[model samples]
Target: MGRVAGKVALVTGGGSGLGAADSELLAQEGATVIVTDVRLEAAQAVADRIGGAAVAMALDVASEAAWQQVIGDIEARFGRLDILINNAGVVVMADCEDTTLEQFRWVNAIMTDGVFLGCKYAIPLMNKGDGGSIVNMSSTGALLGYPIFFAYSAAKGAVRSMTKSIAIMCQDKGYKIRCNSVHPGAIETPMVQEASGRAGQAQAVPDGVLPAGAVGAPSDVAAMVLYLASDESRFVTGAEFVVDNGLTIRP
Candidate 1:
């Protein structure tokens, strides 16, 4: 049951959806979880639910200054940061032709740049102890050509590549850090629910998009995160773990 006991985890976007689930699950496994989101009140609510095992903080993932401040606070408070989950992301559903420069930049800033900053800052703190694990949340869009989500797919593609780069760099530099990306497809989150409405569909995954029933829950992804954060995946790095209900392999 104690998958990550005594670890210190910081989950960006920990206010709702997958982030809230990740925070709660991490705390349940005996880790001190720092829940950070742009929505301070929502973050606080998640933390309160986790009781003494968690704390809430405000973070705008696109800001380098905020990243620095939070990492510093983690070092000061926990003395060691064992896990960093760069799960903060936004999806702009517009095809390549219709997407604007602003939309493209905004998505990349949060999904790509945010993950970069988290790894850049958290590595040193992780190195202080036994090294740490960094989990970047990508999407099935990163692996496929989803015409409906041009910008999101592009940003998540960058995240996937960056994860591999970080993993190799750490290996070469003799840091014990492990970096990997998680790609989830059609998960049951507010984001997906919104997407469903916009796409004029009853379910987030269209009938033929997946081989069979394909929607999943936040806890499904959290279980994978826990394994990555724990010592169980010590040798697993530079990998893309897909929790897509076989959607990627279909057709």
Candidate 2:
């Protein structure tokens, strides 16, 4: 049952949806989880429910100072970091022609810049002991043409590319750390629900974008995260794991 036993794992956006599921699952499998979100109460609520070694903290991923503080705190308390889930993100439902510069910057700041900062700061700590795994949450949006999610797609694309770069760099340096990207499609998460609600639909994708019965649950994605976080995936790095239920392969 202890897939990640004795490990310390940090999840960004751990307050709700996919983040909450990831935190709960990781804790259940034996990691001391740090659940961080911009919403303090929400992150704390998730941590409280998970109990055990789970803790919650407020973190604005867009801020370098916040990243520094959280990583420093983790190092002080845990003495080693083992896993990182860079899953904080925001979606703007604006097409390229209609997206404002501010909106684009905001989405990239959280999703793209956030992942960069998490890896930049956490890697040294991870190196201090045994190197660990970094899972950057990308999306099907990064691989497909979603005109309405212009900024989100761009940010996720950056995440996908960055993951590969980090993976290779660590490999070359002989660090034990591994980096990978996860691409989820139309998962039933709060972010997807809100984006769908804005589009006046029951699901985030248009009727034909997702194949029939292809919608996924948060556990589906969390399972993938678990594998990546565990030693089971030790040989896996710089890879894109798609949890889209075959949606990415549709003709």
- For candidate 1, give the lDDT: 0.91
State the weakest 10-residue window (summed lDDT) of model 2.
Answer: 199-208
Candidate 1 residue spans exceeding 4 A from truth:
198-211
- Candidate 1: tens digits of C-alpha lDDT, residues 3-30: 8999999999999889999999999998
Off by over 4 Å in 2: 198-213
Q: Residue 112's C-alpha lDDT in candidate 2?
A: 91
lDDT of each: 0.91, 0.94
How much is 82 displaced in model 2, in angstroms?
A: 0.3
Q: What lDDT tens digits, residue by residue, belong to model 2 across residues 139-195?
A: 999999999999999999999999999999999999999999999998888887787
CA shift at 22, candidate 2, in angstroms? Answer: 0.4
Cα deviation of 33 in candidate 1 (Å)? 0.2
**Backbone collisions counted per model:** 0, 0
Record all residue pairs in model 1 with backbone atoms less than 3 Å apart, i.e. clashing: none
